[model samples]
Target: MPQPRSTRIAVIGDIHNHWNAQDHLALKSLNADLALFVGDFGNEAVEVVRQISTLDLPIATTFGNHDAWYTATPWGRKRCPYDRDKEDWVKQQMALLDHADTGYRHQDFDTVSVVGGRPFSWGGPEWRFTDFYGEWFGVHNFEESAQRIQEAANAAAHDTLIFLGHNGPTGLGKEPEDTCGKDWRPIGGDYGDPDLAAAIAAVKASGKSVPLVAFGHMHHSLRHTKEVQRTRLCIENGTVYLNAACVPRIMDTEIGTQRNFSVVTLQENQVTEVNLVWVDEGLAIASTECLYTTMKVTEHSASV
Candidate 1:
């Protein structure tokens, strides 16, 4: 008999409260072993968890800037008042966010485990831009985020797969437009950090095989997948990176484009395949253009 297929991981990016038909379709069709969410599930962590749990698959998540809005204690919840009717609606939709903090303490964050005989791990709390959202909702700085990544990496066993953060790995695959040109104006240079870039480079230089590094922070840079250095930046590496932002295409419009997610399948320490599902168009098989099937290290004698 043929060998049974290895585990498949479904990865979703930035579901910013536009969860609806397309979202449901993607979830139902993917049929993944576990659903990895790259954060931004909106202020209602409860609802995000509830809706996602319906898939009946294990979930791993990180916090996005928007998700950090609900850090206040119960009494403080009243400070950010909402319309009674709308508040009632939100309350009824889901209740998982109410326990998100406790859940994080117990479940998600920097860690590692073996799935289908493949080691997998992730880390995040990507840079928090402002306190306008909430104190607990933002990461103090990029350095802190990178440090958490390093900690997770150190904890991972050899031959393990590491998913970096909710944000892309600094320079790789990041677009100047997404970072500095969102509002049709030149903000500055690329939005990614140089330090994060160094960290990823170090991982590549470690001589250990890391196949994927999925991420999602900048929404506009979600179309094409790219390969950077020795690692595939899409889903093929199991160490591949992606930006699964689920924001509406246009403000105030219910319909949108590129409503998508990824499915990763691994077998015997190698990434066999990656499937990208466009909510409306079914599955698009991704090509391994820049994927690294092997890594080479050179040793040289020191010259006098």
Candidate 2:
């Protein structure tokens, strides 16, 4: 028997406790083969868990900043890590899904494999620079985290691989509107994680056919602007990076009207189409584009 060549994956962005019955219903209606969540369930972790429970599909997820707090152990003043459970609550809650953090785990569906992990760069309720330099609260380590991603990508047995990270890898753009883009009006620079970026580059350079890399954390647009559809997707270096962080810093305002969710299609080890869907208002496609062709770029590529 030949393996399945095409797969439809419904990628859900940062719920952050803002997801309503409409959002939940929209997810269930997608009828996708796999449900991939980009983390950030937020303060309503329990309620969010209950909501996703109804999806009734093969699910895979990575931990987000908000999710860390909900799943962490009450040890330090800020629930760092030296003494904590580390999203064990969520793991127990979503026992039926493949959850990866600090390392990578793959879910096989015959022809394709989805390799995902909660890149250990900037996560947890509060992220400090020291967290990546050394070890914050005893869990987050940049070097180790990047190394794990490389190892997992190397060990995978599938030819087609899809990478998932909470906050995407850096180097996509230096602008404040890029994947990890930061406003440089006063102070300029890219806000993405260097370790995550390096790891992603290494995995890609390894000659692995990783066509899709999905992530969340950095939002699309904070202030209301015509660029609402700007940061939702980025196609660079033969890889498609999707920023599924639908909720902006200002919540409840753009929930139903923005492109918060996505349905990504992969065919024959390549990304064929990306449908950025909006669910907060009425379930609809905010943008749909075909992306099977690869475009090469210097260390950094153009983010669509």
Candidate 3:
């Protein structure tokens, strides 16, 4: 019998309410079986979701801090002023696409199975403030979110497990360039979420092999320093962790500024290729790098 084909997945994140013509062009190029967005759809959440839905490809997403704030009571209106109305509309649109805003959800397509959610992380000081606001607006807490992830992992029915999240699991590194990197020069420490890290650890400990873990939220901040500025994809203990937070700042995008995203190929339940791509403002491919490839699933972790 002829062998089944590989599955292509597109990983993108930090869409801060901007998906222009160029972005559309870039997405079309991937021709992926599915696209996973890690969150932060911004105030124009409704419009953006509608636009993306037009692509007709299945999309899976987790809400980010910015996304939570869009529906946050007094805080949301004070920050963006679009609030409630737009948030409601966005939820309706998400339902149409058969996507849950957050929590444990799974899907099986061909040879792959995916579990995705926006974890409630006990983040840094600023994030705590956002968490409090999130609570008031009906967002899940750390413990609750952790339990969901664990259950999802336990119930997964496929060998090729793909985990999707907004904030990455902790312990990747302490360097600013790492997935959960932090600069504690003055105070000194890691900035990743302990809850997320612990949950992931438990999942791995359960013996379920997670081939790819896609996340965003820890973006490279150009304002502070340029030390950690680029797409980060690392393989550790047979699991590939990808940090998809491409936007380095909150400012409006410029003409020549490039957007970061990734394309992953899985064949016969093993990851065969990963491409870290950057698209220019004109919808042209600015750069593309095959970060990793393996003929067999037994290959060890390697950083590129």
Candidate 4:
């Protein structure tokens, strides 16, 4: 367990099957006390989830829209890649995590706790996929879904909570490049989950200290243009909302192919620093980009 003064956490953004053994090694090299995964292992990517299960560390995760790609819609159900899917792939992934899935639930760690929003979400103002949430989460509408999320927060063991989700909550922004904004064609609208938004508001109103809300579905690389990258960090009411989806997390740098992971550190139950560190082939930090910070890392307590 990490000390209260300092807790180091590694945040994995949307993994659209861009994970492998190297990622595990990279994460280990960082020595994060806890790992928070924001979901999207792949399109019902059982093999990918299996790979993640073998990791030896404390983890809290949820499903992304891609995690149920094949089964979420009629189009996908018809052509599920896994012929051996004798069981639901989503369940398979959930079991693979040892039930560490935090969607509409809470995972308590040493100091801070993780409360999840809706899992397997495709963010938007309108709800399109109904059967998926109904069957898996037993949530049919935003009201019920919001209640579940709030219940998780209400049950949290710690005052400082980290809300993890596949897509970010609403009220961040509606611009195309905003954290959870819609970047596709008619580019400009809040692509955040309404239920998640409501739950977050309710949780904050209940007087809990929400340090961060991290997720990754909106890729950093935008579809509209390359002139500007998507805004990945938002600070509102003392909570930091981050989008860790640096797509193609495995990329070829000038030195070699590097793996990316968001390194976040909290001190005194408040976020202090965040960085997107690129680990090289040798499993050493090759480069780093400071995403957000309030003080020097050394100012915090011992980073477990």
Tell me the lDDT of model 1 at 302.
Answer: 9
- TM-score leader: 4
Cand. 2 Cα-lDDT: 0.60
Query: Quick one: best lDDT, which candidate?
Result: 4
TM-score of each: 0.57, 0.73, 0.77, 0.93
- Model 2 residue runs over 4 Å out of place are 1-5, 20-22, 70-103, 119-140, 184-187, 223-230, 248-259, 279-304
Q: What residue pairs clash in candidate 4, if any at all? A: none
> Which lDDT tens digits does candidate 1 get at residues 1-304?
8985566766776777767555666566667766666666666455655676565456655555445443333433565455554554234332443332111122232223321100111112233333421243233554543454444454555545545345554444323333211212342234444435555556556665566555556664323333311122333223544444434421221443445566666655455655544544342222222222233111110001
Off by over 4 Å in 4: 1-4, 83-85, 295-304
Model 1 segments more than 4 A misplaced = 1-5, 20-26, 53-55, 69-79, 82-141, 173-184, 193-198, 203-208, 221-239, 249-259, 279-304
Candidate 4 TM-score, C-alpha based: 0.93
Please, what is the whole-model Cα lDDT of each candidate in the order they appear? 0.45, 0.60, 0.64, 0.86
Candidate 4 residue-wise lDDT, 1-304, digit = tens: 8656789999998888888888898999999999999998988888999988888999999889998888788898888777644677877888888557898899999898999999889888887688878887788899999999999999989988999999998888888978888999898999999999899988889899998889999998999989988887878877888889999888887778988899998899888888988899898899888877785332211121
lDDT of 2 by residue, 1-304 (tens): 9875778888877777766666666676676887777777764265666666555567767666565453343432265433334544544444533342323556666566666654323532233545322432233556666676677666777767787877777666765556666543443356666556677778777777878888887766544344433355677766888777766522244343543557877777777777655544455444444323333322322544
Worst 10 residues of 3 by lDDT: 295-304
**C-alpha positional error of residue 284 in candidate 4 after TM-score superposition, expressed in Å:** 1.2
